[model samples]
Target: MGLTHEFFLLRSESDDEPVEQVVLSDNLVLYIWDSFRWIPAFNPSTKENHVGLNYHGITLIRHEGANLLKDICLSWSSLFSLAPSTLQLTGDFVMDENGNGRYEKLNFTRDDLTKPLTTLAAIADRAFLENYIIVHHGI
Candidate 1:
């Protein structure tokens, strides 16, 4: 009924196609939107512009981006005292400076952000440790 993100984890290190998929909550998608570059999940439908599908798509996160995200998440972990319980999720996903964010209130924790963050990190770590091609999917 609403837009959400899907994180596809590659089942094999040698495989580019993902066998498992995760649909992230819409609110978490918005809260963590700023952490990602958006290009990770490349969808042709939104070549010019789109939100749901884009946020709803699973993009790739290169090592650099993943590293940055890891660092950011670390900072967030340090910054927030409640671990994840205090991580307020405001569903204003359509990030517009002019105040166009919809579904703007929820006490949801970082469960949404945590999953992607871990997934992205795993992708990066595995690529590095296993010595494989790490082309990111568009997140």
Candidate 2:
């Protein structure tokens, strides 16, 4: 059986709105999981949002195994130039009863999630939405 887990969504302050469109609020979400890969609950929170110059965000999947990831999926605009003007990530690591290393919870921080894909608009020419989707990279 899989282990229990949780998820969180963190909003950052470095958004990509024009100087005239900047908003100063941050938001985040956390999703809890059960042994069968089902989300039992979720939590959301808010903060100041802006903490750096280059925007950052991350995704964490707590699976029953041992592994680490270096990359994740983002909207083409997020990779390019869009509403996501900032990014940051903070997560935790632990071992489950099965002796597998996993993340109990994940934290993601972005300026915005619904930004348009202006930079990688060209990418759409080669792939569909399924091509860029982010799935759990279990270990």
Candidate 3:
């Protein structure tokens, strides 16, 4: 199989609750609760970073109607680093409920500004885990 990328979000069927946008790609899986504005992007080996346009908070909580949302949320964060030209993933994970998450490394390289910035790309198909702890905490 080849490397695949996708964007996702967890939303409530009712309007009384807030929606959660989730992003699971390779060794990184981010959960944004629509409050902190900080979407998490993690790499099992190199580093993990969250992407957002602004810096709100690392977490957010919303209580609307008769429902309460108590889950990991990212808000109020900005993508300070320009989108990396590449990503280097060093692990594998099942980030989705249906067991469709990808695991690998991404190499992010800088571009020469004049070449029409190349679309960011990631490398997949490698497994480099320190142990079960890496999978559990995902730090």
Off by over 4 Å in 1: 11-23, 38-58, 77-87, 93-103, 110-116, 131-139
Error of 3 at 25 (Å): 2.3
What C-alpha lDDT do the candidate models reach, one value each? 0.47, 0.24, 0.24
Better of 1 and 2 by lDDT: 1
Cand. 1 TM to true fold? 0.50
- Full-model lDDT, candidate 3: 0.24
Best by lDDT: 1
- Model 1 lowest lDDT segment of ten: 49-58
Question: Model 3, range 1-139, lDDT digits (tens) per residue?
Answer: 2322232121321232322222233223332224323323333233433332122212211112001111121111123134455534345454777877776453433332111111111000001111100111111
Local accuracy of candidate 1 as per-residue lDDT tens digits, 21-115:
44555555556556654323333444432212244333444333434544654454344435656455455545568867666566645554565
State the lDDT of candidate 2 residue by residue for 65-120, as single tens digits: 10111111123224434323455433357788899996654333343422312211
RMSD of 1: 6.7
